[model samples]
Target: MFEILLALLAGIAAGALNAVGGGGTFVALPALVALGLTPVTANALSRIALVPGALAGAWVCRREIGPVGPTSMRELTAVSVVGGGVGAGLLLVLPASSFDAAAPWLLAFATVVLAFGRRVSQALSDRLGRSVALSSRALLTGQFFIAVYGGYFGGAVGVMMLALWGIGLGLDSAAGNPMRIAQLAAIFASATVLFLVASDALSAPLLLGAMLVGAVAGGYGGAHLARRLPAPLLRGVLLTTAVTTTVLYFLRG
Candidate 1:
């Protein structure tokens, strides 16, 4: 019962984080693993539980969803769906041990990116004397790879996307957030379908259900709340989550 409650709370925090800035997996994944699921199964189940919440957040921000410069949302979403499916397939085929070993380093890298991505983007833009914008094809290709990662592990993929778009197309994080949530939904939705059909993600029905419910509530409310937050505060919460989660993972190792 206690573990179940923990899962519920974790889901709420994760969903809220993703809605605001994207670091939900850092909470949701570790929470499941601590509950005794294997790393691969935890990853699969987290994706399953978080999809609806992502969509809820996306819906709240639907009016704010906008273009990524040259790349239309339609094209990016198509690539995300296909790439997410492929990445989910890979997770099922690969060894679980591999994922367990790689998890900490992946989280660390993502933490660093989430922490400094925007600043780095601005730095590069200043260095070049203009914001670098990718062609439509290039942008789509980059999104494909990120979506693939999103399906496979999905910690800070939204932040990564924001960083990429900010660097490549000079997109503002706040303005691009709605579309980020939407694309995250698309990626997780495709991945969830594959996991439901192919993986043991449904083994813990109660745990999944609890988290799912909590996430939906969190995502819906967080989206609206995020609109009122100052950008720096949002980034601070994201970074703090990332750092704390990364430290916990390393300690567990």
Candidate 2:
């Protein structure tokens, strides 16, 4: 009973951490494991626990949904949603060991994009500018790949989303919130349904209720904090998180 309560409180903190920087999973995940859940179960529980934070972040930044196209918003949102669901479904059949092993590499890849994301975004934007056509099918494909990675081991989905927008969508990674939030929306919805449905231990009533409250609180706090932080600091946070998560996962393995 006390453990469950602790998980809730800890989850909120993790959500805030995630919202602010990008490494809340490291915090919430370890806490869940220490509370006695298996890694896969912990992963599922963590997903359920963080949905509220993701949704809140997206809602707070609703106005920034995508490029100036009429259908851009629809495409990004739809891709994210479908990709998230597919990734979540993959979680049920895929071996956690495989995802866990690749976790460090994923972190490294996302972190590299984060570190140089601005330059990449600028260079790409200069070439394509704001007029480059966004390929929905390609974007959706990327989203699906990212979603699968996120579902299996979502250590740095934010960084990945930022890079995708910058590189793929020809958008300013640091400026707008809509595209990234939309991706998060997809991640949250799919993860929520997957974990809540597939993971036996995570399907508990008390846990889910607590997870819900904690996620919402943390997500709200995270978004507010993110909104206040400058780009330089946020990038620094991403760098630190990337390195820390990489080390932690490798050490754990």
Model 1 RMSD, rounded to 1 decimal: 1.1
Residue-wise lDDT of candidate 2 within 147-237, one digit each (tens)? 7767666766766766666666565554645556556757767766877767774445676567668878987877888777886886676
Any runs in candidate 2 off by more than 4 Å, and if so which? 1-6, 66-71, 123-132, 201-211
Global Cα lDDT for candidate 2: 0.68
Candidate 1 on 43-93: residue-level lDDT in tens? 999999999899999999988887789888888899999989888988888
Per-candidate count of clashing residue pairs (backbone under 3 Å):
0, 2
TM-score, one value per model: 0.97, 0.81
lDDT of 1: 0.90
